[model samples]
Target chain A: MPDAGSRTASIGLEGGRAVTARPTAGAPRSVRATAARIAGDWLPAVPLLILAVLLLVLPTAVVVLQSFRGETGGITLANWAETLSRKSDRRAIATSLELGALVGTISLLIGAPLAWAISRALPAARTAWLSLLNVGANFGGIGLAFAYTAVLGTYGMVTLALQRLGLPFTPPPSTSFTGLAMAYFYTNIPLFILLTLPAMHTVRDDWMEAAEVCSATRFQFWRHVGIPILTPFLLAGWVLIFTWTVGIYGLAYALAGSAPAAPVRLMTLQIGIALNQSANGQQRAAVMAAILLIIATVSLVTYRIILRRATRWFS
Target chain B: MVFVGRLGRGALFAALAIYLLLPLSAVLLSSFATTWTANPLPDGYTLASWGEALANPRLQAAVARTFGLAAAVLVLDILLVVPAVYWQRVRNPRIRVVTELCAAIPFVLPFIVIAFGILKLTGFAIPSLLGTPPLLLLGHAAIAFPFLYWSVDGAMAAANVVKLNEAAQMCGATPLQTLRHIIVPNIGPGLATGGMLVFATSFGEFALVQVLVGARFENVSLYSLDLLTRTSADFGTLAVLTVLTFIVLFVISTGVVWSNRGKRGTAVAGARAMTAEKDA
Candidate 1:
């Protein structure tokens, strides 16, 4: 093929005695070659580098800086101190963390089996399920809050049905912490399925068959091999979802109006009801945003580590 | 044992179906219902709510603006990411790690936090740009960048873009021509899928839009939030609007899945590129 011919020719030219065709050291041609090499290496990366600095790095720096600045314009730890000391702020942080953990765990438990089933199903069924999951995964934010309300709110369809059936139980209102967690789970379970589906395909059927030939029972094979291989992916998914839930504001804000979560609290303090009600509300919100940034950074680092481990199996 | 296994599988399918369809059916039914309060089924069915939703000028504007903004974001992301990814793949492989980390930043951080940072930064750094559609566009592009980059990167790898580039250049094709004829057509599926996914995501995005531009701009998600928040909020109308949003998303996703149907093998190969990305 023409492709193979060029590749071989280039390799041969590099490998063979071609020193005489090259420019001498310290000559203008060598200088030009060096310049060309440097341009080739870094020029294409410039646009991305600029975008990263402007969009990601600089804003992050601004948050960090604002978190330390007080009303008087000098640097101070007062914002951090007040954020930590305030009972309401501390509770919001705790609630956010607890919600993230709860949602992450629930989604993983529900999604793993579905991912396994989808992977092992017929091709047509797999495609259908995968597409459905993709839709659900993307179906989040305000629309999700509305759907949940229609299903489980005070006058919701299911809630009313249960009321008529004399079940003596009503689901929580769509604004409570528990309700918010349920809504988060609705979207994220599908997200977990989508994220893990690709990873699950890496589990080879031959590996399972080989274990069977070695007298390993299905349970034993799964316990020793399947679970081990799936652990990193599950952990990565958990962390990703956890971070996702932590940063969420629209659903909680839309459903609950004002919930005791870090994101909602930050919004309230920044520009909502809490804004300008206090002298330092803006600074406090900045501090809280910075704290959330820290939590996100930690989650990302853990995700990267788990992804590294997961990629080993993938490769 | 086989019977038990079949029973388990059957139960799993039942759960999956219920989980996927229940909320959707609720939304669909409520949209057409005249009144659905405190009843197992709606008391009456009507298209009045759908008409009311469609008749509202704000809702109409919201739909138009949502598509416009999403389209702009998609174009900007493709333009910015394709070259960076192409260059990284073809010229400087060493910078892959830095670019990947940059792309992953938005995925790791919450949109709320990113919005907060952008809001504060723009307030001081570029006050003129604040509360504009362009700012929101920038935010959407940043958030959607990773998806676009990864999809195109995977497709590029699957297409053996490096070899194709080399061959094209040896045949005296310029870089621009190579990109136009070789790279774009080969990675058409990835570009389409990425574009559609970004469009769907931006259409549904709320936090950034709510924080960055608020009511100055109205997207579908924000419009839905507005309806729900009003004291005299109409559930039927909200339901209709929700269904409309779902239909648009459903259509786009169907296109993506349909385009992906016969190309399953290449899709797997594309996914492997992401795995290789992590290894770097």
Candidate 2:
């Protein structure tokens, strides 16, 4: 019930109506005091502010400026023009969206259930299951791609085993679009679990008890209580995963045979291709990065909004 | 809800375990294979790939370099985030918003874009930094920002570092002494957890190093990539390298879990902070 913001609400007590009675003494207010407080807040954080500006702001600025810089040493929109006009670039953007949606849907289906299962387990099992999921989530990048190929590729162990059993279905090679989807799914299911598990704990058994006392069937309780409580958290999780799909590089980069010829032309891989194209390529890469940045920012903000709504619902 | 009761849940967990364990164990299996093709398991197991992995100069350099880079990034993150986060929590609470925003840049930019930005700047503005270890080091530190920030913030809030500092100072202890004897001891688990994640992150990082320096300053991830891409490259070597890297990460993660042992899953502050971070 006691959250950070409410707990600190009494600190300044501007109108002298404090939110809490903690026997706290309020500092006398004056113009000098206000100035000193502002100074206190900003001054100690200067080094951090500088680092934030230098590391995050400066490089991002470079990306934005370079996006507009011309190859002939003059400002030009030719790069942007080509980028927008190109079919491959547009397809890459489409691919990113489709991939995000596909992976998000599948991961949610698997991970949400797994999270519920883990949440119901004994504490020891719960901890161990989470640790395994953590391992799975972190087992990524070149290693993940390479490992997936060995397990699910044309001559992969699983593929070969399925062949021996004369199964009707054969999974695609890890380099193929379907295989890449599977690989992304492998990482994402765990990620979804990790992100949504905490929100699950917020569901109380007492609420379900109250529902049963109201003569509600188990299914009815889930429909009115469980799903509604978890929908926002699940949507937020989906959005988070979707955001990563657009920007993810390492996994796709490893799987990309060559940037331009990659089986899947994710926005990130497209940016990689653009960066390697020379002066014009670098410019194109910048423009793409900026576009991707905007999409990522918007998706992340949506995630935050959904999460805020979820928390408010909980309260 | 009865449709998926205890029995159904057990089946679901079993499936999850297989999905998680299959590929990784396959990698391990391949690493020890003398020759394996078109089979459920390796035809023969040998230490040949492990030997080859150890013998290669590039692999050795890559492994050593990855550790070095991870170490540097972890140190840099602690230096930049710990004191700053502590100060914000204890002295300037309002600055929390800015710190949080800055920390979440990694989530918004996607690492590839971050790599691109860094690559572009170093090419023109800071030519000396281009293709240098320092640039990659800085890149890793920047990307590893949110992990350290959230960890320290949670630890500070949990320990109520402010109240501790106030209590100590009121009792006439110097600021440095309070930090030395009280703050560090209390936030140790948070720092350790965050440090582990940062180390794991930098160690596994591929895109930035691959784009910026490529084979020039090859770390383990780049080395694994090199084996995958090159003609006449050995999958065995790649598998061996990957397994080794996974083991290191596994140990670090175990350390993370171990440090939070008594607190139960609910109070695994850093682990949960990492989840919220990815939410960003």
Candidate 3:
């Protein structure tokens, strides 16, 4: 109570009341401060909070509700059952995972080394490279797709260059799923580099120096020290890239010929097709279920990982 | 020791740099080429693409509309969110936890799902909020709120709100007066950075606009998409437009990064002043 009144009196004093305050006066000022703090902090969160929850909950609920209902009124799991049994739907799921995994792996292989090189370079060089990588990293989806089309499309320069070089210029499979994966991997490399740059700072020259002094081989040093220290960052970055690649539609949409050919047509694309085809309720329900499943799984996993990691600082 | 490895490192970094810059360079090249059929190199060079893209009246109008919508969304979001976040920060931990979780949903939920929900719920309403520019702005603001919230919240967290408020009260300033006189000026950098970020994102966004508004109102990105897909492929015009977009994004992103860094530096000094004033 005394603490509270002192805070209140302090408010009174600062507001130019020009009066000396007792311990009792601080209590009300503290209460008012607490009130003001709450008002300021929580108010801005409302719109986002409301929108996020609705977005997370609503479509999903609708999906689940619709997926079960028959053409008439009987509640059944037939839609979900059908989603799995249907060859096209099954292929869609497989394609999404395969493309995501491929992209994630390739990007990691290329990006990690680049990140290491940049981190170990001179400060000026590192800053310039990092800035370039930042732009490239963000230049994904539509922008990258467009660029690749110009550079590697049927009439792309790369295709032409290969022809002039007297090499077998087979258009580099630009329209295929493989080409799409390559594009995704290219974009992911910059992002991977950016994510791991912060963690790479943890690897100091002194540590490398000690390793060299000890006469450890380069591979040995990486295996024993570098990998272990960077495991958390690597895992975190990989998971993000993996999930992002899974949900990507733009790159695949732009490059792939159609719903069937695209290697990574997502549930959302399926929903789009259904909506366009006038499948109506079933399409909505299907989208709801797939998105709900995705959101729930991702949120749960990310939350658990982040929570465990966060507690390490305190421990 | 680092000097010994400098040559190898420089070569490596240079390769990485080429990878990042090449695609952009290619786009620029294709745009300027007067005759760049499926040839390995351009046959000639000209400024026709730039003229072609700019000459179209619709494309010009869409660019203007996009800028207007971005500005409006930036202002509307800041005005609405500041009050909400400011109040939440003052409240108890329980309230803060719930609110923070809510704000994070938009980021986690993909644009596809959000578009579906918006279209479903607001389908019949006209000016057809989902299909109109204003509707797009509203959807954008909803999606953009979290970025602004975090930026401002981080700024406020750096600032000592409790002390600032109490000090203002002691100086005979009311709640409204304290917010305007003390808090707003101090957090101006955060506000500006957040606004710039929102503008950059909304300006560049393609998915939401494509789905929500369809072709009812086209932004630059959409226009580019249409140009690529339709008619004779005009590589030159796209290249010019892309270069223009890249420059705009670079400038906006630079402003946000610079302002946020400046705000971070000022936060400590601002905190000290608030504490000093409180003690006095």
Candidate 4:
């Protein structure tokens, strides 16, 4: 990774040395050349910089700032204190972490094998599966909640069919935590498959064959070679899923209404019912939002670190 | 061992098929089911729910609004993302990592948190812009930027945009003329793919619309959620809306894939040529 200045200078030397080397008769051409060089360096970065500052950085700053504001407008930690002290707020945080971990684990359990299979499948089959997974990965939010209800709700098609078949237990209503987890599985499993398939493909046949030549059994080869190589990718995938589930609000909200998930509780407290009723509702919402942001940032940083490690292995 | 391997593969395929299709089929069935009380199959099927959903004035309004917002977001995405990506790739490749991290912030952070933050920031920063469509548009554009930028960047890289620009300039084409005649045409597939992705995402986006302007604006997803939450909620109608959304997203994604397929050979050829030129 050469710096932009060096790369541009090299290209300029190769392509425009004659023009650059010529002695300028006046200051205007030199000034123009200097101006062109500056524009060439900085102009492209301006739009992305502006977008980052205005959209991402400023809003995040506002959340962090507002989380510290007290009722009377003075800067204080009272909002964070009051918000965190509540039993329900603590419960929301605990529940969210639990759900994220559970979703990450379960989806990976299913997704890894699926990614492995897809990676080993014939090319046409692989393409078909990948395309389906791509479409399915985006099947989330309110629409997904509705789909799950149609499958798992009290009068759901699957639920009713299971009852007709004399199954011992009924599927839980879509409003339950169990039901929300089930709905999330639909999105998470496909997402994991999509995310991990490329990594799975990176485990070349030649490596396994080399292991076999070394008198390693299939299971031994996988344990010694495959799993070690895939560990970083797997860990990164899980972290991504964890962060995704932690920040997810729509699927849980649509499924459970105001009932089940911590994300819903935070939202209700922030913008929904609590905002109108409580005087310091906005501050509390900011606090909760800040907490969610911190969780996401930590998970993302972990994911990036894992990805960097994974790149070292693959590269 | 061979028999076991075949069985394992077959089972994997079967499980994936069921896992992916079962929920979707249930929704599709319920949309047409006259009664699906206690059987594996629907008692009978009808298009009444589809007709009802289509006829509903609110659904119509929502469809119009969703498309309008999606279109606005797509335009914004193109205007901002194309230049930014072009700049990063051609002029300042060193900033690539930073641009990527910034673009990825939306994907990492939940839409709810982003919406909430924007809502709070706008209240004090641009009081007049709060709760307006433009505010929502800005949020959607930010959310959609990463997809657009990556797609366009890939195309620009494959096309070897710097060499193309140099060639056009040597041929006496002005910068603007070179961009219009050479670069845009070459990256048509990337532009279309990015536009379609932005449109699909914006059309189906729920959290931003629900959080920022839920009181005033009703998009398809928000409206569907409203229908789903009511005590006397019509499952059939909800199913219809879900199917409609799926159909729209499916078509747009298919278009993207189809365009990519058509251009794959050329993109590969161009990439090889670029590498060859670099080697020379």
Every candidate's TM-score, chain A alone: 0.82, 0.84, 0.75, 0.83
Name the 10 consecutive residues with the lowest summed lDDT in model 4 chain B: B268-277
Residue B3 in model 2: shift from native, Å? 4.1
Q: What lDDT does candidate 4 reach at residue A206?
A: 96
Q: What digit string (tens of lDDT, one per residue) describes model 3 on residues A202-249?
A: 666788889999999777888898777666556656665676676665
What's the DockQ of model 4?
Answer: 0.40
Displacement of the residue B210 alpha carbon in candidate 4, Å:
0.9
Q: Sort the predicted structures by DockQ, highest score first.
A: 2, 1, 4, 3
lDDT per prediction? 0.74, 0.76, 0.63, 0.73
Q: Give candidate 3 regions above 4 Å deviation.
A: A1-75, A204-206, A209-220, A257-264, A276-285, A288-296, A303-307, A310-315, B1-4, B124-128, B260-280
Q: Chain A only: give the TM-score of model 3.
A: 0.75
Give the alpha carbon lDDT tens digit for every residue of B1-280 in model 3.
1222667777877777787787877788877888876577788888888888789687688789778888988987787667665554443224445545545455445555566656655653343455777778877887776677666765665575657766787799876687778887877877877777788768877657776787888887777776665658556676777777777776776666467442212111111111111222
Candidate 1 wrongly placed segments (more than 4 Å): A1-48, A258-280, B1-4, B262-280
Per-residue lDDT of B46 in model 4: 98
Model 3 docking category: acceptable
TM-score of the second chain for every model: 0.90, 0.89, 0.85, 0.87
Least accurate stretch of 10 residues (summed lDDT) in model 3 chain B?
A: B268-277
Ranking by TM-score: 2, 1, 4, 3
- Interface RMSD after interface superposition, each candidate: 6.7, 4.9, 9.1, 6.4
TM-score of 2: 0.90
Over 4 Å off, model 4: A1-48, A259-280, B1-4, B93-98, B257-280
The global Cα lDDT (0 to 1) of model 1 is 0.74
